[model samples]
Target: MINAESSAERTVAGPLRAAWGSRAEASALADVLLPPSTALPGFADPERWPPNALTRLASVLDLARSERGTPWPQPTASQYARFFRDGDGDRTDYETPVFDLDHRLTRAVLAALVSRDDDLLDEVADGVLLLCERSTWCWPAHEEHHRLRGAVVPDPDLPYLDLGAGVVAAQLAWLDHVLGDRLDVRWPGLRARVRREVRVRVLDPFTSRHDWHWLGLDGDVHNWCPWICGNVLVAALRLVDDPADRARIVADTVRAIDRYLAALPPDGSVDEGFEYWWNGACRALEALDLLEHATGGRLTAADVPVVRETVRFPRLMHLGGPWYVNLADARALPSGGQPWHVPQEWARRVGDRDVALHAAAQRSTAIPDTAELGRALRDLATPLPDHPAEPLVGSVWLPGTQVGLARATAGSTAGPTLVIKGGHNDENHNHNDVGSVIVAIDGVPVLVDAGRPTYTKQTFSADRYDIWTMQSSWHNVPEVRGTPQGTGRDHRARDVTVEDTADRFQVRLDLAPAYRVPALRSWWRTATLHRDRQRVTIEDSWDFADHGDSRSTLHYLLAGDVVRDGPGRLVVHPVSGARATLVAWNPSLASAALTVRELDDPLLRTVWGEKLTRLELRLPDPARGSLMIMVEVCA
Candidate 1:
């Protein structure tokens, strides 16, 4: 194991220090971020706070109070380990209880504080103590650590600082910070246990260890780094009393955040898709918000350009209507009622009204829970400006992941839009798609990506690629010599370039390297969007230096409804008058035969709410040849 003390020491003078600049800036940021140990702010009484300000807050508390009658679910070691031994079947049952408990305790405490319901104070006190005393507040995977080959996770008595566990502790700290005076009134030791558990699981372990994958100390960074660090900031700011100790934790958090930032491409494209972007980047923003609040204004996302760019990913990733271009293990289609506060709030921080407006246009008036009192409070403080949806301008090319976005007009959801992707198969949540594309007309999707299935043991195991939804065969790409694209960072597209204009959009990708076959020479696909023409033409050309009879099969995935129109044309019928006509080129190939296959995966069911259909184009395989597919949308 690495000497965590040394690692923590380096954090003070390392990349984070460089991001902060100078010893003075670092010291000042640490001061504002940790704030001298003091009493946490109390929850303002709803009666006198603001009119209807606590309405959503009250609703959250009411739901929790209602659920109080439901028995708290218990999780056992066997139930937790079932996934490791048997797969993903029973793990959710074990997990349901944890979420229920977390929600239960959170609601009880918020009700006691927000409504000042003295009747629920004892329940709040008991809830906090029970959570703090749970054998494991973390998920089965984190506590068991079965990911590594033949590795046995140490059975520690202390509550783990995993994402789930860390968030729970952070909430407990908030409870203690605001109502410690009240909680202390009941058990006295309850507040002390909150602090001790946080130290034992989060602070001490985080500052001293580099073993956590999310810490990014080993050079690999992803969503977890920012997610868990956010909770650390929550716990440390409200619970850790010692200034030096708090600074140490904050330094590690800053250092960890640097890892998440470092993982992002310079162009700010999230290859893991927008759903994970929300899960990760949004959480990071929350941490930054806390840091900004604690430190007055000396340090925050406003000081960093990359932070602004990173937070802008969600809006730019939109793939026309009803989708945000989610790829990989992310949901194939973005759900309705997406959260807008992160982008809206981040845009306001950076003073970018355009982005702020984009988020505002799509913002919903719904609120999920008051458990995240910090974010709720921030939401209340930063009132979003009402902004209407605008047409999307030109096109966006994220060179890092080779993901391209082109729309007919700026913010035109129901217009001609094309999202093309050509990156390696190994990403945060990878899928083996080298040359894949999606086509949407007037916000109606004609060609789509089979994003993912309900996660199970196979989803994250060595057999991950075995799942059809994760393979290139299931994507908008072709299979060469009956072999699909390989999975790994090394298995990526090469020689990718894009050209965009007011009326014409073209993306060219050299996908020869992604396949692992000696006989494979070169495979290239180009997607051209004629904006005014409302037409998209996808051309695939391939050749082998020394081969024949290659046998390549082209495929396309579609949602909603589709039907055969003619010899070389098929029409897709959506809910309204929005219809897309697909025309296959190369006369002979376009007229060849078309077959339909249904995907019965839950992921597809979740997105389409029904089984999605796949269209197959059986092109005559000459070993070395070309194929073309066209999709034209009519106004």
Candidate 2:
């Protein structure tokens, strides 16, 4: 635990005095504030609130409080005090040793207030307000004074203020005093400083430009960065007196929302996993909520079905629990990262129980009554009265030659369809995995995607390419000239065809158009799954043409423990100890070898276990090549 009283004393008073310049500006800005008469488009409809959902949520909160023997359902501010004090408090670093655990507790406490738990609400609100008053307003720089200093002196263009600390401060203020009256009293100077920083540093610079530009020149257009930044601007607009400035912020936010919404694939697949989804989606939803609340429902209605469908997309494609594969920088397995339910509360408010169910399922491990919620979700997910025949396609083609695809078949045992990856290495947060496929059989992962490791300096540098998850050597891909297939801007996959019959279903993917080398021309891959009641045969084929002397090697890197193996056959085991065999056809001309290597890197080894097995098949020489591998499973 942390010493809350002591920590608060050090941060609050001195910073207030230093922010006198900002306080003066804040007073000036407040004088010009004007509320918007018109609501922005794409906000949720006020008429569609879900029936009994709030009551159910209230019941859950009541149960939690009863079980925990606390007035509130969650931990106290004192219990969360240490999270704000653990690290060196560097802003740029990914590892924040100290976090305000009370933030989530406060959110839960506020959410629980829907049940009329006024006593708990008052207690939690008082603690949160006190904590906010004592602790520094923004992080990376503890106080508004430090933030203002950085904004004015060192960096005139403070880009991270929108996504990082500024948004957090705004959210905290919203929780502390819903009407913004109490915040004007106790933290008058601090609030003033924040307003000044926003107006001079952020709003002025952003309003001048209209094209798609992010804060840092990192070229990383992440989901939450713009979304949260927009929401924070909206919050700032609420307090500012200048009508022009307020209108500018609101217009900028709406435009940014349009751009952000456009990035979401038509099928509702977001490249960043559930974590990013929560951050980005919730911010967008909050903006929508705020627009409705402020303007009395004048905003245009969002496509509720589409938004709800997007929320359900992840659940339909989930491997297990919180473990979603690395579609685009997504971890294949679940870590102890925060769950998606934090934002799902907003989803429930919009009358999307299906979306709520998805969130509930992902966060079930943390919430005690999640099993019941999961069951309820399953009932809701049952086959519709008039379901469509075509298997849902959750795939998107990005500008940088990135083709990401995910599909789910009709029948339970028919299994989820092929989830394919073929693209460039230069894309945002990308790995070297070109032409990697993670297949699920009977809703269970037969071919696995090893999730991401912890991000540290060591992990990013020397150990980056070494991990099986990040390496091309660990995927089910073809090896070009005894080396992993190098990625370029032109790399992509298309001309896909699927044929389904009574006994067999085959999917053929054309990759010849993706590569540039003349020798690798006409390169195509095919996977045929033949079902015979309880057993299935998965046959793969690679066809290539026009190489006189060049040799090509096809390989499958098994990323799991080796349970057992015969003299010739390599048997790789999964977490559930399910047996899967790796069989190569042309082993005589091309040698096949299986090697079990331990994950030596500290960051990767911590998340995934120490050991993994790689199965490699090396081809000697071929003029025009063809290679094949078959995986058969039987109970």
Best by TM-score: 1
How would you encode candidate 1's per-residue C-alpha lDDT over 1-635 as one tens digit per residue? 34343545454543335556543243544555534344233343444444445654666767767765456656666667666677444457567677767767766766777645565777776677677667666776666445544433335554456888777877877767656676667567777777887788777877766677677666667888888898887888888767767776776687677667767777666777888886687777777766666766555567565677776677787664456676777764666545577788788878877778778777644445633655544443445455576445457888877888887776666556788998888887888888899887766566877688766667767888888888898888877777788888888888888899888899988887888877777788999888878778898888776665556678788776777766766677653335555555566763344445565765577676554567776666565677778787643
Candidate 2 weakest lDDT stretch, 10 residues: 378-387
Candidate 2: clashing pairs of residues = 32-241, 32-242, 33-240, 33-241, 33-242, 83-98, 83-99, 332-451
Output the TM-score of candidate 1: 0.90
Tens digits of per-residue lDDT for model 2, 1-635:
22122433223322112222232122332333335222222112212324433443454465445533233222233323322333423233321322333333333443433434544444444544443343322333322333355331123344434454444444443443332344344445544654555555445545554332332122245565455555455555544556556655654455455445545555555555444554564555555555444434444224443344455544544544334555544555544433355335545665666555555544432222332221222222221122122223333222223333333333232333345555555444556665666655433445655556554333334455664566666666666655564554455556666555655555566665444555565556766554433333333344446444555555564545554344435554444433453443545556777676677755445434676566666665654545565554433
For candidate 2, the TM-score is: 0.65
lDDT of 2 at 374: 17
Pick the lDDT winner: 1
**Looking at candidate 2, what is the lDDT of residue 220?**
40
